[model samples]
Target: MNAAAIDTSTPRLRDFPYRLRDNVRFGDLDPNQHVNNAVYATYFETGRVTLMKDPQYGLMLPGFAWIMVRLDMHFRAELRWPGQIELGLGVARFGRTSVTCDQVVFSEGRCIASAQAVMVLIDEETRKPAPLTAELISALQPWLRRGVKGTRPDLA
Candidate 1:
């Protein structure tokens, strides 16, 4: 099979997860006409924030906040100038005190980059790790990917 044929059948990563679409402005490109590396990080942030703000998901409990504990990213392809991009994200693991999420940035139906993050739940006053609330979990239940493995480690 030719490269074009291979690409056509490979599932577009955007189709599998919740995605947000954005257009790349000229300002988002560099002198070389490729998207600035920093902008890809912003795309990941956009995906996470969108998920959190949705009424069906997010830090639902009063006085609860999800703080980033760590982030990891891998770049697979360069995104060139002048194209629409889609950012995809989904919960990888949800724990009592923390959750891990995966996000991908796509251009022209191809995944250009991917990022993974670990976010911990914090108590507003104590500023320390806290158990995941049932209400909060229920809110995120609809977004969880089926057949995902392993339980979240105790983060407190």
Candidate 2:
């Protein structure tokens, strides 16, 4: 909910199942010379796409496509033009028909922003929530924090 509340100390770090890099172009800055608030969402999307398509845990199977149902981003610090950021991602929750991820953007090792996204597994043909498969669930289990283990085990 609050971006500042994110524990930057440990950073919810996993191997960053995915990382996306984006350079701040002149166009990304506002009159105040800071990156526009809206652009951070694009960075977050890049990370989410990479996570879904990563070979380690592809959200879409043979006949399904996972679609984002909701997202919340909290920007703790401002990034200026010409800066580059690494978007870190990991599974925060995996459910029978949905998954949530904690995404953080970093520059020079400092967390500039963070986001949480919720996506629903959809049947390619019917476009409705579809149960995730066991194999997929197992693939994502390692990325969960130890304490959160079994919290969303229904996915398995």
Candidate 3:
């Protein structure tokens, strides 16, 4: 599909605050000469890493770890190699111990795929769900998408 045919006026694309640029490498493609379905998960991981590792927006805490609990992805279009991709990320919802992240992959100004992943905060030593700290919640507030319900108060 031609990049020019993509629609970029979606609210999700406009609302996402975190973005990362990546390249489609030769290794990312499969026998079909397009990026493999499995590779989309890796791209989402890269976006997660980029957002969670940012000094100002980072979620990493000492003695804490994040565990992915769920992922839902939609492959909108096939991705080709030798091109650049833009990854957009946002927090869809937050819970006491987990957060749902929404992400989209775009190439040539067109969205190729989108995904939602749930990640839980855990105590590294105990391997148990951990409450989100005030500091962590504050940091994430800026990335929250409006109108998205968040936090199971009972869990909090």
Per TM-score, the best of the predicted structures is 3
Which candidate, 1 or 3, has the higher TM-score? 3
Give the lDDT of residue 30 in candidate 2.
83
lDDT of 1 by residue, 61-92 (tens): 67878788877777778887678888877777
Per-candidate TM vs. native? 0.80, 0.80, 0.86
The number of clashing residue pairs in model 3 is: 0
**62-97 per-residue lDDT for model 3 (tens digits):** 899889999888888889988999998888877778
- Runs of candidate 3 exceeding 4 Å displacement: 1-11, 146-156
RMSD (Å) per prediction: 6.7, 3.8, 6.4
TM-score of 3: 0.86
Clash pairs for candidate 3? none
Which residue segments of model 2 deviate by more than 4 Å? 1-17, 55-57, 145-147, 151-156
Tens-place lDDT digits, model 2, residues 17-127: 556776777887888899888888888888878767876565558888878888888888889878787888777787778888888888877788888888888898998
lDDT to native, each model: 0.74, 0.76, 0.83
Model 1, TM vs. native: 0.80
